[model samples]
Target: MSAAAQRVDTGRAAHGALARQLRLARQGRSMLFPFIGRSRRFEIWAHYPRHDAVDSSGRWQFYFHVHDRAEKDSARHPQEHGHIHLFRRSPQGKLTHFAGLALDARGLPLCWFATNQWVTGERWADAASLVRELAHFELRLRGPLSGAGLWLGDMVRFYATPLRQMLEQRDAALERHCRRHDQTRAQAWADRRVAVWSSLPVNWPQDALSAAGPLTQ
Candidate 1:
């Protein structure tokens, strides 16, 4: 288990840059706007949730979007705006899907969840392995994508406890599904009908306002 696979102390709120960028983006438009500067407004809205935030080293990345994404039949999980998918590219170059941050129409985070393979077309990693990667998900290289990576890393730290809990529930859900249905069907987890397997309600960060800043030189 490398340190990158473990949680560590992140510096001050400077990494809150991602959230700040999101806020500025919403200044005159809608939820999660100002994407890469804009392309005819909502014309590109809801389009596969662009990967605006990324790590130069490709170790970790984060991207978010909004739309109706919830079980149509079940009211247990009310659909909100959309979700942010976090990714990690291993040294072996394998792309692993970590977890998702569900957001409201107003761009506020509502829940944390894990999706089946079909949803994001990503390789599956057990909850334990994904948990370890959360800490080292940082992007320090100087570039357009740097701030977003740092901001995402901050998000993992800020909601570490709750995120971990939701992932546990995700694993439990998969086990229950397999036992009741068919264990031999490895692709069962990739069923398109089930987008989000497990989720936990999230409280919007109070520090978001503080994240805006009064930077001192």
Candidate 2:
């Protein structure tokens, strides 16, 4: 009934429609990642229908590179502590915009802004309701859709540990950064940030979907 609720509903509806289309398009599919070698190198990839793109059929897909242990350790600058990259392509195979997720050292998403010639930002909690919405969308593609399961599996393998480490390190770094910046205010600021993040609704509309069944039907 509220504006925030409306936005969430819209996102759910959009995702549901996209999922059905994916099911139909990929019905006989067995493996989403046919490419060989280090599939783990590429995690969290999915194709979704999008109207904004030049192509109408919505073949656009995005991939996320949460963290590359090898590259992150080797890179000279390492501007990204850990990030998600999104890519899209037209049905004709023309490249579209590439986006990124920028998180602080603690892995909490920041505001959506652009970086490195790519769009980057935190997920909108107000609009999305739950962090898992993003994860679920990725998983759904792997689930009912078949063949795409590898994407979800690879995502879990590649990101699970690194993401956990990123969050832990981020929290530690914030605590340290705050203490160094101002010992007297560090605890208060950290507490406030934690409270704010915790207070934000982090559960998806699982109950609604469970009661209503798959939105695609």
Q: What is the TM-score of each candidate against the true structure?
A: 0.71, 0.27
User: In each prediction, how many residue pairs overlap at the backbone (N, C-alpha, C within less than 3 A)?
Assistant: 1, 4
Model 2: worst 10 consecutive residues (lDDT sum): 195-204
What tens-digit string does per-residue lDDT give for candidate 2 at 67-148? 4546423321234344433334445565432223443343333322212211222221121122222332333233222333
User: What's model 2's overall lDDT?
Assistant: 0.33
Q: Give the runs in model 2 whose Cα sits over 4 Å from its true position.
A: 1-58, 66-80, 104-107, 115-140, 143-217
Pick the lDDT winner: 1
Per-residue lDDT tens digits for candidate 1, residues 95-125, read 7777777666655566777787777777788
> What TM-score quantifies how close candidate 2 is to the native fold?
0.27
Provide the global lDDT of candidate 1 against the true structure. Answer: 0.60
C-alpha RMSD by candidate, in order: 5.0, 13.3
After superposition, the stretches of candidate 1 with alpha carbons farther than 4 Å from their true spots are 1-31, 34-37, 41-53, 68-79, 91-93, 141-145, 207-217
